[model samples]
Target: MLPRRSRLTGASSSDRGLPNATVARLPLYLRALTQLRSQGSQTCSSDQLAESTGVSSANVRKDLSHLGSHGTRGVGYDVDHLRAEIAQAIGQTQDWNVVLVGAGNLGTALAAYPGFTSRGSRIVAVVDADPARVGEQVGDLSIESIDQLETIITERSVSIAIVATPGQAAQDVADQLVGAGVTSILNLAPVALRVPEGVDVRQVDVAAELQILAYHEQRKGHPREEAEVSR
Candidate 1:
């Protein structure tokens, strides 16, 4: 059996609440540690970790401090220890069953995505509304009709659902996911959804990021003109 430390950092340190932002960074650290471990680097300085994770050295130290100081002043952090700590904290040590809805282009890409497999999330089911796609195979899982969502959720005890349908169908799919007992949703649709109080919804708007960048770029060349137009 793996050591208790390998179970998950957050589960072990449940008493000490971690900030959501810090929790989000744990994966970045974990990925960096994985690379370091592969390279046979047993220890790493905060600066090295920060460079790999695209975070600052101070912020890395601060984030690690939340899980208690596992680093030495001169020797840096032990790779194995840091990986276990982060795995435990983010609950990645345990497998998470996930369901993907809408086997369209985006949904198919998500179903084929390798990121979730390496992390803790496993796509146990792929759901779609089209009858023709219902029995099709995606990755290792077969595409099932959305009609089977509730049954599949109950059977697999899936807690997370990924909505990859069209913008018009996003809300409807989300509603059905909620009704089927999925508490967390990662929405790839272009539209915002209204979920219940307990349901957690995370939107991934790929175009919005580009749009924001474009808005800033437009202002950079014509700041006065843009400001006057706004005024």
Candidate 2:
């Protein structure tokens, strides 16, 4: 039997009411639960979830515990109930109005992504500094001028924004977003941003992720090279 610390808990002491590691893994659990629900699964074991999400079963159980969820020893967890719990925990139970800054290739692609809508976040406005890109169409949104950023945010009641501008322009856009009442930002730019105390920024650097993967590939190939050299 797992200890009390490993079992479901009613609360956490970490910042944001949950540990950062647990918060990060919640999405993985949610995604796995969503897939199971889609496949008509009514109950799933921690092992099953771990297999789907590539995490250790013990970690999976511990993470869910932080959300106050525990499964029966033999029957596991009710899939639908767990899914709802995770969604609510991650603030996906309600829709969030989001604004997009920068309408370049990466920005446009993000604006067109349907995954955000599934998570109850919708990009309500698209803005760019370049006048030529303004008035362009991205899905159901027309690119608006950067000049209208605050106005669009206020009119749409947007508190979340996606900053996909160039690395150089990202900080300026982030500043504008923070001034426009944006409390959360998804920054796709490679550069780090400095925002006010209460603002939350999540950075997504694709190039850096690829470089990390390249590092792993380099390590994996080194052993083969060493073996060949010894022959």
lDDT of 1 by residue, 1-231 (tens): 322332235343455468777887999999999999999999999999999989998889988877774488899999998888788778888889999998998889889999987888999999999999878989888899999999999999899999999999999989998998899999999999999998988899999989999998988989789779876
Please give the TM-score that candidate 1 achieves against the real structure: 0.87
Model 2 misplacement above 4 A: 1-15, 224-231
- List the candidates' TM-scores in order: 0.87, 0.90
Off by over 4 Å in 1: 1-16, 220-231
lDDT measured at residue 52 in model 2 versus the true structure, 0 to 100: 98
Question: How well is each residue in 38-119 modelled by candidate 2, as lDDT tens digits?
Answer: 8989999999999999999999988888876788899999999888888888888988999999898999998999898887
Model 1: ten consecutive residues of lowest lDDT: 1-10
Which clashing pairs does model 2 show?
none
Best-fitting candidate, scored by TM-score: 2
Best-matching candidate per lDDT: 2
